[model samples]
Target: MKNKILVLGATGNIGRPLVENLLARGEQVKAASRSGQDVLGAEGVVFDYFKPESFEQAFEDVNRAYIMLAAGYVQAKDLLIPLIEFAASRNIKVVLQTAFGVDADDAIPYRQVELALIQSGTPYVILRPNWFADNFHTFWKAGIDHGQLAIPAGDGKSSFIDVRDIAESAAAALRTEQFDGQAFNLTGPEAFSYAEAAQLLTEVIGKPISYNAIDDDTFIDMLTSAGVPADYAVFLSSIFYPVRQGWTSVITDDVATLTGKPPRSLKTYAQDHRQQLANS
Candidate 1:
């Protein structure tokens, strides 16, 4: 068997496109999810963060792997470190997906996982992506359908990146050693406040969508009331601190630098997913 690239979270927003891109370029791919469901053009394997028995089979004969923590798992290090260690033992290069602004800080859960990767003495590249523009169609679609998007981002802006760019960058890192031992802060072409994003979406989808900037407590309460776990809701609201503080309003050329093309804008993303935005 040829050495395949193992992509964890294969059914996720970033993994799906990453698998597609790699297969298009003639690279072998093993798409791993909890269900072991196959990507359209790739082999499928069962891999779950809470289930360690699945790791060996998933890593078998794989030369490189893309690692990402699935949603609702706050203990990123616990889930990620074992995979990193196993990959290191097998000499498999890793391309890890972490949120933007998480660094080698011991306090931040994701950063602690990052520190382990760096200290493992293995070949690795990290892609820290900004808030995803895709969330408009996925996580926040119900609100969009109601003509209102509510979050606690306040008047601050975020250079919300399209997940496609993140996948492209991950593919590049996995295919080459040029960016090994480095981390890229992937972002879109520009920053936009929630209100501004709403305006752009309104224009593209031909509807009046508004952004409601609520308080953190209110946001957490709303999420919990909607069936989101209280701890996870708190986690979600906590991350928005950077956005409200204007820290996330950063734009970078990292996506262009890695993919050799400009990242997609909010307008373009909304236009491409207009059907979902219009109807969802």
Candidate 2:
């Protein structure tokens, strides 16, 4: 396999582009998903976090890995810790993607995983990315389509990042050792409140879009009524606390620092995904 890199969540937002970036750089990659589906030119491997037996072939002959927990797995530590232990035991380098506000706090499951990596005696890099601009076309697309971008963010802002920049940054961390033992907060160049974001989308998409800042209770009710799990709904609503507190509004140069280019702006993101937004 030529010391391939193992990329978990291989078909996801970051994993897909990360795999493509590595291949473009002439590096061997093992693209892993729960289904073991083929990812373009890379070798395919089946990897399920809930099924530990699948980790062996996925990690076989792998020198490094890009690790990201799947979305909505609030009990992330239960799944991630085992994988980290296995990778550390194999002496494989790890690049972990965690939430933006997660830190070394033991109470947070993702943070617990971060502390595990930090104390694992293995080389690793941590990437904490802010809110994704692509959410407008993915998670909140229905709201956008309805011309009402509603959330519990109040008047706070977030320096929303592009998944492309995150992919490039992950590739850099995986391919190089300079970033080992370091953590980077990847964010866009500017921060925008929901109202401001709605304005920008309106301008770029050539349509009216409104931002409705709702209360936490109302937000939870909406998600629950939409068939989202009650626990996960509360979890989703909890993250907005930071947004409402202005904690997510911090801008950083880490994207450019790692990728050697400025992160994409909201306008650029909207333009690139114009057809998707237009359809919404």
Residue runs of model 2 more than 4 Å from their true location after superposition:
none
lDDT of 1 by residue, 1-280 (tens): 6479999999999999999999998999999999898997699999988889999999988999999998777888888999899998888899999999987356898888888899888899999999999999988998899999999999999999999999999999999889999999999999999999999999999999999999999999999998999999999999998999998998998998888899998888988999988985
Worst 10 residues of 2 by lDDT: 101-110
Query: At residue 183, what lDDT does model 2 achieve?
Result: 92
TM-score for all predictions? 0.98, 0.97
RMSD of each: 1.1, 1.2
lDDT of 1 at 103: 72
RMSD versus native structure for model 1: 1.1
* Residue 169, model 2: Cα distance from true site in angstroms: 0.3
Give the count of colliding residue pairs in each prediction.
Answer: 0, 0
